[model samples]
Target: MKRFHVHVVVPKLDESVRFYSSMFGANPTVLKDDYAKWMLEDPRVNFAISARGGEAGVNHLGFQVDSEEELTALREQVVAGSVEIQDQPGAQCCYAASDKYWTQDPAGVPWETYHTLGDIPLFGADSHEKTVAGASSACCAPAVSIPAVVQRKVGCG
Candidate 1:
């Protein structure tokens, strides 16, 4: 089953964890000093929060697939919609190694489509890559400029 993934950039991890825990009515499935995740069965969502650099709101949203095949299909879907996608074959982000495709919504919010390969000990890769938003993205979010034509078709331009 594919899970809906929502990553929120939080100002305070401990405070957000407490609020979400109460809202979900369960403790986080995984909790770290600066990150927390709730793998909720009822909602079938992978909800995560981190004290990462960015606005304190939705960092990105993604679909968490169970296999690479599913991830490929998602990439194709984005392409078919005329949106350009940036591929990350083995990206270590959000404490997981994943094969992912990154793209932006018409409104320019980052969206990820990925299959988790395994877990890692860190939030993201060590060396920072220049991101679309400048500096580095919180969770290996790819930095790509969508073509003007593509953006126009999607009403972003």
Candidate 2:
């Protein structure tokens, strides 16, 4: 079965962690200096927080698979279906050990599937820093532009 979770960005990692710990009545299972995540097993949801750009709120949310084999098979299925696979399996990312595949629907909403294997690389305190930076550098493209519009009064051009 696929596991679903949301990743929330936070301005203050420590503050968020403390608040969540109190609200949930349990400490986060995975805690790093720059990142913290609470695996609420009872509810089967993962709430994660990271201190990056001092921005708070949802990052990217999706399902977590159970094994590498599952992830690899999913990737193959996605590819065989001819739906573009955004990220192929075998890429190290997000402080999680596993293979993953990212796919987007026709409406442009993204979905991800992966299986966690073991500990993830710190990449210097903030794991997202390295991962996000590499993405921007390698996968990023120029933003598309839109034409500006001008409004006129009834009598004014």
Candidate 3:
């Protein structure tokens, strides 16, 4: 099984948590001082929000896979589609260790495909401080410049 993932940066963590909780009709499965996550079974989504002081909007979207095989399958699909991808074999982010690949959509929205390994104490194992938008240094995929030809074919430009 794969769970759709959405991470958002918020200005007010507590208020956003409260609003999301009310809207989802449930409390967060994991709540930290600055972060909250709701693992919803009904929708099969891993929705998270944090007040790290960055922009108050969507940070990234992802698919959370249950196994390495599923992750590999997704990577194959991305490759077949000729999309630019960055592979993080063992990444520690959002308090979980995962093997992930990162890419951007035509509109430049970042997307992640990962298989969670386990949980960790810190948001990320990297040394970089949180960004003004409240996202960790490893929160999103590093930007990759798309080739003009590919961009044109995809109507990106």
- Give the per-residue lDDT digits (tens) of candidate 3, residues 66-117: 9999999999988877777767777777888888877778787778889989
Off by over 4 Å in 2: 72-83, 105-109, 123-157
- Which run of 10 residues does model 2 get worst, by summed lDDT? 138-147
lDDT of 2: 0.59
> Where does candidate 1 stray beyond 4 Å?
129-138, 143-157
Which is superior by lDDT, 1 or 2? 1
RMSD for each model, in Å, please? 3.8, 9.6, 5.0
Per-residue lDDT of candidate 2, residues 1-157 (tens digit): 6567667768888899899999888998888877778888777877777775533666556677787677777778767766665553444545665555555555444555767666656522232322322443111110111112223346756
lDDT of each: 0.80, 0.59, 0.79
Q: Output the TM-score of candidate 2.
A: 0.66
